[model samples]
Target: MNTLLKRQLLRGLLLAACLPGVAMAASIQALNYSSREVDYIAVENPGNTNSGGGGDSIRPYGQGGSICCFSVPEKWHADLKVVVVYQLSPDPTFHRETVSVPQYPDGKSGDIWLIVYEDGSVGAVVSLYGPSRPEWPGKIKGYPVPTKEYRDERRKEKIKREKAVLHSMENALDGDVSDLTPVELMRLKGAIEYSKKLINILEENDK
Candidate 1:
């Protein structure tokens, strides 16, 4: 799980209780269930690494081992998923460094996010600090913030989708006029004409 996915999964789970569809009872159930699940996974040194020849991770969440934060499906099922693909990270110290096993081989203390899917695809992230860990853990606060580059990329995709829709509509206008009601036909034609005129005006202004 990258930063964006981590933040999103947590934020969604945290807000699940408040979402419209899920009943308040279910939300409360799920929230409590998730908390317990998190505690279960987090132990005093889940495992240790000796690559750097140090030892297994001895840091409990607050001190003994890593906090080891991760998420489960809102339903808390053994097989519920939330994404196409996801990856859990090792430790926050490794993000900036190489992935050598023996390099700083100590358990990490941070967050993990796992988004599982019905199809078995997943997305996940693990890190040391909140920022490096892909996302924060708050709904009101910033959790699933996309990077500037990611935002720009999404904007481009939106523009492309809009253009595709416009092109399809323009093509439909030339295809059939028989099935459409009079009012519908009139609106479609007017929209097409107005768009063409707008394009012409813009071109003229540019010239």
Candidate 2:
């Protein structure tokens, strides 16, 4: 082959060899945000604003809120979906939630959510929330708190016997039974018998 023809052939071969690697690199980007898993983008505690805290490296949204969007690639809606979880203002007003596209008239559309928490910790309370799961978009509702019944202080006397039995059971597992102390062992035996009876009663009730 001539000099020019030889160079052209070499370039074409190199391009073909590199095409697979280029395509794989594009796929890696999608892997970072996949529909099979949930991703979290934590934000600063809105309760703490004295530091002029709202948006920063740790928090991406503004004082108002932050949003993330995902969608099905190539317009393929089946076996693939996109999820967008967002952070919204803690304010009770202004709908105080997130909503997704194709709010209605759906046949395999993406999902969206707005999660509101005082902080990004377990102890932090979740305020206003919204969802679009198994139905249309609307405020996510929660159950009301139930009242706890009062326990009299005099009942404390009865707990001592239970505590003693528990202690004996703990010691029994340590192989410290050399000092088995018949009184302690007797208490443990009685506790075990009572517990077995209670369990039987519960099983019968369940049935």
Candidate 3:
């Protein structure tokens, strides 16, 4: 081949070799906000803000419970949007809104949420409802929603965590309360109470 032909061929080969790596290097920008999944809460606007019901009517399928999805306020409907946050990725002190763990049953959404907590820990919430097997934009309509299967997995994991915590607290209770400092005793008591509450919730769901 002539000099120019050889140069062109070599360039083409190099470009082909780098194509796969370049593709792999690109990160998925789907805005998949999650926890360990992080404890992400789906705030209507932000980690805090208007997530709590401010009189907005039930969303798309409000009949099935808000977990299925909720609609944006009418004021913002013309340009309404549901931002699927991935994380705080910033200082919590500067934030005005907060992400709280939603109450049982209602909190589940197969979709991923990104938010920060008071302590600055990133929180992610997986749908414990939505759909059983969702396919993307098709499965979701006005707003993003998770599938039932995803929620089931999260529910199980939550139950496991709660049980583990309960076990530890129960074991601690077996020890002498006299040895614990006042503060330590107070925290232990609080944890025991919280753990039991969580256990009760999970058990109730099972029934």
- The model with the greatest TM-score is 3
Per-residue lDDT of model 2, residues 1-207, tens digit only: 766434434543443355432111010011011111113322221332221111211122111222221111223222321222232234222221222223222432232222333242111111112232335333323321112221222234335454566566655645666566888868767776675565455445434
Q: Which candidate, 1 or 2, has the higher TM-score?
A: 1
How accurate locally is residue 29 in candidate 1, as Cα lDDT from 0 to 100? Answer: 8
Please, what are the lDDT tens digits per residue for candidate 1 over residues 126-204?
3233422333322212232344554455456655655566677788988877899999988988877766665555445
Looking at model 3, residue 130 earns an lDDT score of 32
Model 1 segments beyond 4 Å from truth? Answer: 1-142, 187-207
**For model 3, what is the error of residue 182's alpha carbon versus the real structure, in angstroms, after optimal superposition?**
3.0
Candidate 1 lDDT score relative to the true structure? 0.32
Report the number of clashing residue pairs per model: 24, 0, 24
Per-model lDDT: 0.32, 0.30, 0.40
Candidate 3 per-residue C-alpha lDDT over 133-184 given as tens digits, one digit per residue, 9 for 90 to 100: 3432222223334445556676888899888878888888887778899999
Q: How much is 180 displaced in model 2, in angstroms?
A: 2.3
Give TM per candidate.
0.30, 0.20, 0.34
Q: What alpha-carbon RMSD in Å does predicted model 1 have with respect to the real structure?
A: 17.2
